[model samples]
Target: MQGEDDLRGLAKIMGFMRAVSIILVIMHLYWFCYGFFAQRQWTLELINKILQNFNKTAGLFSHSLYSKLFAVLLLGLSCLGTKGVKNEKISWKKILIISSIGTVLFFFNSFLLKFPASGATSFYILSTGAGYILLMQAGVWISRLLTTNLMTDVFNNENESFQQETRLLYNEYSVNLPTKFYYHGNWHKGWINVVNPFRATIVLGTPGSGKSYAVVNNYIRQHIEKGFSMYIYDFKFDDLSTIAYNHLLKHSHSYRVKPKFYVINFDDPRRSHRCNPLNPEFMTDISDAYEAAYTIMLNLNRSWIQKQGDFFVESPIILLAAII
Candidate 1:
């Protein structure tokens, strides 16, 4: 039985190694293509043209596309490498850290030497080469890490068992608390009580519905003041800015308040201003909440599809009808 278990573990490791190898190969291919065929001069000109046409507004579409493409590529490589190792011990945290570091270094080097018009000088050439070497080493390290049984905590420890494992039967479709919420204390005169954490609810209404005020003023003031980190993805700078500014002044703690307002004017590149969130010159306003929500959903769905291949699989007619 012990021998069989060892064999299974080895097989899982081998599977992960194979997947990492494929991912590395793909990365190499991308680099080669960019270096040889997609000439930097042309690419820069193209980007300039795109910027000229779309200006700051291009971020709405372009950023999402770029993010999704990278995400899918990573997910595909992961799936290919660990198709049959679903039950195997995996250190996701370590994997994330290593992968993020590798990606950052890759871009850093590429931007520094490769993208700039002037090529690397004799003094910096060796350093640039060393950076590339480190990137390749990072990739190899990730591959080895994935294959090795380094994460003993995953299976060998009872105390470290996840909540799902503690339960007898595992069901993925369990109701859980929404990650975020908008609460209004001032509107109802403290009538709003703390709702059960497990329930997912959305308070929807028109402009005067107190949604923005609740989210920015009341909820942020109550929860965020108590050391909770919160993010408000406000597209059009409005009430969020007001609340943030007020919080900064009122709180004795040095609260850093920054508002980023983008002036996406196609006419003038110089006028295309983006304020720093920490030292924001403008207010926080979000125009299209629906578009923002849709973007979030789209990304979420893509991630879901990557994790569970059959997540969106349905009858042909049903799928087609839904798409229509």
Candidate 2:
């Protein structure tokens, strides 16, 4: 029991670390987006400039080297943090020692490279700037790598926990249900095998056989603590509104509940009003709201078909029929 509790505690810590690492990675990725997509050549040029500036002996012996070295150390620290190392064990003493050595080397190199034609100060400044940039890159890389590792670890841990929880639940309810619940297939059937809290055991039943309640009570409620987001589509407003309200109330500020109901009747003015506000309305020059809704529906349908992985030469005909 103690072992299980310890595992659970470690799992929780790992989960939190994973979330933080992911957030940091996302922020770093956002910052690097321009370099990745738009200004890649400029970024490479800047890196090259830094390398050239550091090649000079005087440029090498500056505060810039210490800064670069410290930056690298910071990246290592981030990795250690992700790995669940305590803050006290981070070894600031070692980092300071290395930084001091780097600082001395930088100044010595600067003195050696102070020739008649060389602009030692300018070179030092450029090298230092380059080193700072490299440090940022190192931090980003460390965050990204740690995020990946943490996610993988947490996923594995959660999967095992889920299996254990499911078994316990099954034992409690096995007498009630005909089929015994067991782990099977990818929890989330996407490109990656993500363990979906919602997509658990599929109900083998016809309509109005309590399938909906079974899904809601058994799966959704069970994983409520895991910070799962869900959207339930129901034609009836009352059911959907109730579910949405309950979700909003239960989750409070931490979770979001968005209920989207398809209003097929475009002829009714109220129906038009009920449509997604951001939806395009090409029919009226004043507002493209209806058109936007239509586009969303079309995209949803297309996505469904794509998920099915069925392609045909006559797909255009089927799509036209759907539009009609």
Candidate 3:
């Protein structure tokens, strides 16, 4: 991880390098096209002028050549190398090798044009050298940035609360379920690992603090919209049950499927369905029986503060587990 400043700095440097590479590529391409199609007579005139001024006759100046075409191809390769370096798709050493070869070829072309001794040629040579130097500098800085470690800057371990909050973001989830979590006054989408078979959500808040409302408004609405099956436990109040029932009704009307809703209230003797923890249907297998016995013992004790239970308390659980 890197700090925002470091990341932004690296990006800006890469941008500058990319710009330089593109400019070099375009300049070479323009020169190549001009030399190939339009600049034959001008090249002849320039060569004649150079020969006359230098007081020398050279066979090399007798004909127009496609030297700029080679420059164009080399510069194009350099541009691609710079782009790859910026994207981290090419190794720095490889880019350096490619750019160095391009630079050598560029300098060779410049050398071929240097004997003409014109103001335009001098400026072109200076600018090309400066551009290539900047490109190399950018590459070096980018490599440094990639190699440097900024883990401490990005993660402030001294801030325990911040670490705790960020830890939830990296949790492995079976499904990335979106939760329109309300944080810092605005509603933003977050994700939870509740879809995992071993994972579940536990929302806790004091009474009248919108705990039920948050679940009903955000999560319940999402489940209904996505046509997902949901099981809600509303212990004290029927808030969640009512919200689920309404959503189910709306969904049924829209999809034309009459979904069933089961309610089991242990507090209401008249309306509550009979639920037996010791039913034979629950103990058909050893795993089921073990689970049933554990659940029964948990419900009876309600707390595990004392791990080593006294004989009076442990004897019944052991007896019930053995019998099951």
Per-model CA lDDT versus the true structure = 0.42, 0.42, 0.52
- Which digits, one per residue and each the tens of the lDDT, describe model 1 over residues 134-172? 444444455545554545534433322222211222123
- Alpha-carbon runs more than 4 Å astray in model 3: 1-209, 253-258, 302-305, 308-314, 322-324
lDDT of 3 by residue, 209-279 (tens): 98766554566765665556677778754777787888788776544455677778877767656677678
Q: List the candidate 2 regions with Cα displacement exceeding 4 Å.
A: 1-166, 169-201, 217-225, 256-324
Which scores greater on lDDT, model 1 or model 3?
Answer: 3
lDDT of 2 by residue, 203-240 (tens): 57887787756554434443333344555444554465
Clashes of 2: 13
Top TM-score hit: 3
RMSD of 1: 30.1
lDDT at 323, model 1: 36
Comparison by TM-score, 2 against 3, better one: 3
Query: What's the lDDT for residue 123 in model 2?
Result: 53
The number of residue pairs in model 3 that clash at the backbone is 0
| Candidate 1 TM-score, true structure as reference | 0.22
Mark the regions of model 1 whose C-alpha exceeds 4 Å error after superposition.
1-190, 195-201, 214-216, 252-324
Order candidates by TM-score, high to low: 3, 2, 1
